[model samples]
Target: RVKETATHKAGAYATVTVPAGSTATYTVTVSSGGTSATGSGSYTAGTTINIYAGSRSGYTFTGWTSSDVTITNASSKNASFTMPAKNVTVTANWSYSSGGGGSSTNATLSDTKVEFDKNEVDDLKVTLKSGSYNLRSIKNGSYTLREGKDYTISGKTVTIKASYLDSLKEGKHSLTFDMSGGTDPVLTIIVSDTTKTDPQEEKPSVEDPVNFEDVKSSDWFYDAVNYIYKAGLMVGTSDTTFSPYTDTIRGMIVAILHRLEGSPKADIANGFTDVGSDKYYTKAVAWASENRIVSGYGNDIFGAEDSITREQLAAILMNYAQYKGYDVSMRADLSKFADGESISPWAKDAISWANAEGLIQGSGSQLMPTGNAQRSQVAAILQRFIETITK
Candidate 1:
């Protein structure tokens, strides 16, 4: 409290009062595998407060948990939120990957069946067994559910979004869970209606046709490019040109794989001297490096801008498959290719695995291991990779 005194010429006094502003407190914590940035502090309401989760070696950051506060990117290791009028606590979740000196185990989710009213907005949770696993996809007959938009997973709980439930028809539907480990679980969802109502026909959604001038319908990579574009994995260099012949850079490939994982946040700086700090591929490169997807040139260099060769792409993709806990034991007899003997020793296993998986095919009698890969070739390889795993 403060007090003021004033005297005028006629010995009269007037007083003005002022009050101190209020502030909100914020606290951040990490469950494991990382450390939170020093975000515990008091700030004025509506102030933008930054939070960070610095991941330790061998641990992967999952997501953030905050009840009342709305984080800008809850899944990012580095995120921000506005300070509310009251105190808030944010916790970051992290997990250990197999490569991080952790033993692997076969895990599965418990099959669950639930019935609810069509107007109900409660989320459904599925129990996950003890193990580190990733949700590959959710399938309902021929329809696939999109993560984040349709559902979200945190730790052992898989929450079926209320919006997704409300969108379903009043009938029994089975959602098959495609997990990375053990047996896949099935979720039986039965939406019921309390009152009789006429069934409304859902309008079919029309997909825009791919119209890249450089990618003609007769081109060998036409379907691959179309798949890549539709999957939201790649885009054209221009509005009308796919630039199919352009050389794909190392950074671009890393960025594509990052997108395939929904672009999980990696706030830590990747120790690549060649990779720029503010480039568009910075976060993607960091995430890839942390996941052991790409190991660049020695001496702390990633060569993000350099064009990636066939062998390099194979090696990177192989590492990625292994990280995803996919079966990468398949090997092809490279002796069939004439120049197979010329393939680099370090990438031999990767090249063999890629060939066996039909992700990379040779032309005529040459494997072209050292040749720089074109955008079209990469698109084809990625399409084949996706098909092989989804099956």
Candidate 2:
């Protein structure tokens, strides 16, 4: 018999390796203070074996197994026995420590799971199909949009709830999506009114002499003249010459406005010494000053005879739009016009807004904004204004 010695205080483990083709029974013994206990396992050659503590005064056994075995003398004071043919290696592990308490050797396992639910109604989408031009004009009732309706997204098989749908005039509109606190992409959609007539192509009727013979008789001025005329905003001179090529003067323009407003009589004393009470445009000039439409040229002199320029016309139109409760600020962009820097400071915003909103187009790339505004240009401006409000 081969002999090996293993010493453990209590609650410990001892491992023993036996040689192949070895047969024997092995025993493990533990002692603490004066108490002791023993356990044994039997195995044949070519097998491994292990022995564990059975019972003792103050001890336990953990993780011990037997596959090969050996026998040894079990009658010695703290003496360990071993088998020579097994040539086994034995290891003793102690659990009882000097100060730290004991702990379990079992391991813990962990796992996680994920789940999802399918939704029936996925999204809602909205689009502006038309009326982009009128919508931007800041004019009321000229353009309308559909309201309080529902639409669906077809390709994705998703149901959309549209609280409102607006009927805008024919044009390109943008589509947008609302995704429950998430970002929704945008798409462009076209809305059209196939039945609408082309106002530009409509000829001036020969029977309506008062409407057709004005300086705005040509088709180019038709829309502008009609709109201003229908609104009672502008009128022609006594000679019936709309004077499409003639330059508009400051005093004449004011008189036209006074007439458009029903020629409201002025009670205040004339502020300009140069304008006499008997002058043809006296009432109009005085009223214009009172209404903040026209200011003096300099030193209280109202240059009523000077021709109005393109820039000046733009300023007046924009101001009129504002007075009518339209917000022209959105179109403000002075830099777009080459002559923007030359415009009067007071008229800058109004002119820029008019140009940007397509209400007034520049003469070529350069705006020639400071140049005299002829009757034809004025007619065009008026036509665009009328079309905007009517649409």
Candidate 3:
């Protein structure tokens, strides 16, 4: 409390009052992405506050935000900071899961069913659309084909052992490919008589179309696959296979984007602890990260090898486009999709822009926003994104 006294000349005196106690207080408000036990609070000047974020299934907490001060642990679930002398607003952040975002499959075999005409010196070789396609098991009836003993697998080629081939009966037999994490259709093998001796037809030279033996020119993603390969933004799983149905990992996509940027020298520090210095994508990750084109999971982990989803890719591309001076504003409404709500809140704007710009399409009425992205889809989207920007 304060009091003031005034004297007018020597005879008259007046009393006055003055306000006191002017300590500043601040309000701390939390935002979206996850729920907080304490939504908001009030604190006196220079008061320290501890804030922790809750975890959501299939989402990772990327930290908090405040207008007044830099968040101490922006990427961790638990964080704390001192309150400033003004109203402070902080928000929770999360990244979507890329492991299971879509229903799309991987590149399949050109000949889902293979036939053997000769067995004496000929090996039953199967070619996959993607060299990296996972082969869980090959089953003939109840007997599983031993990987090294019965056959050998390398890159896109799967070879049947000469010993196994010789022991096979000369009747119609079937082999089934059991694999995971791909959209590849069912592939089968038929072993017929192996005595016919005839010269095989000439193979297509490398100068031919980008079509691998497995990818027909008539396939939906043929053009997109070819465009990316020719543009050097992407390539086949091997010299001849594109693995169109293969899941594209976070690291691989960033590398592709980096290439599209003409492999510019970013000279940015590698902030992610997961990306090793000896990794092929280390420089690319550093560049994309430095340019604000990509983000890692909380705790400084990028999950580089983890599969990325369509919406995730959309968000990433949106960031890259904006960095390149492209307009990524919300031009399209996404309420039409059945799973529109499945789109992560942080990715809503980017997905909206991609959808509005016609850079990405949905499955009938479903956007499958949380589904994993296939390599073929990446190629197609990358082509569309590049065209949109260049045009």
Candidate 4:
């Protein structure tokens, strides 16, 4: 026999008991035009879970619907809901659009999973598809990440700091990036044990190798130097030394670009008196001047021996991109950099475009627009330009 007392009153509080060991399963499905939806898992009752919707090619994400639970922000590509005591499923809707969405666009992350060695200090770089978007928030479960402290943004790339990754325990973790104008992406981070040896490091491959004594495999610009060297875009100062730290001269830069252009003969002579006809860079200067890729310093003289500044290099590359009919419309907001105001007015657009395209990654919080670019730095910039822009 059971005895209980019940009172019926307005605004009365009632307590409900969920059975021990009970779990709720969350599942997500998509409509005909949709591809896949994330955020399906088993969780305890009353746990809030994030759901992100994805659309197939030639389709755009519309909205979401749930028959059993109330979804928060159903119209957004990323949404959330509290898990009920019973199993529930959410459905993502999509529509077809044949026309291209121009500047107003949706973006996707380049990768869904990333790995980090506990002892390594390399930041986790996550790239996004071509679009203009702002990051709203980054969440690891219920915890919110603070920018600059946890991560930094450059163009469409989000770099999670190594300090933050090192703090995480050695295991798998998930982070959700909520951004505007696109699907909010989730990243799975696998933190590896520092004590364990990586077998790949035992015998490194030497294909298309650069045997410069100064350029080590551990250097940050190693691959870039190797790439430019093997491609015949740049060569070492000596057979033994690459002089990676040496400042690059204007003539050298033009010569490299001329080599990239197949070293075509100039139809007319360049009007610069300083560039001699017998010099190695004379044809390059002539070709560059004829193509309008560069304009020598104001007084009918090309300072061929002068060290090229960061802004000048950016402008030259921008001019080259324009000549090649590549898109130069994308521009990044340079206000984040401390020295943004220092960029020359003439090179403003070029620097902005280069920053947005990841061609000129500035020193921490400083663009250093007036600083001279070094040989290794130029090699890295050329590598980025070729891999991203030309490809």
Best by lDDT: 4
lDDT of 3 at 390: 39
List the global CA lDDT of all models: 0.76, 0.50, 0.70, 0.78
Candidate 2 lDDT, tens digit per residue, 152-204? 43433323232111223334434333222223333343433344457754433
Residue 209, candidate 4: how far off, in angstroms?
Answer: 1.0
Instruction: Enumerate clash totals for all models, in the order shown.
Output: 0, 28, 11, 0
RMSD of each: 18.2, 30.8, 27.0, 22.4
The TM-score of predicted model 4 comes to 0.48
lDDT of 3 by residue, 241-358 (tens): 8888999999999988888667767666788999998876888999988767888877899999999988889889887766543445556779999899999998898888889887
- Cα lDDT tens digits, model 1, 39-92, are 554444555666666666667778888886888888988777876767677787
Model 4 clash count equals: 0
TM-score of 1: 0.50
Clashes of 1: 0
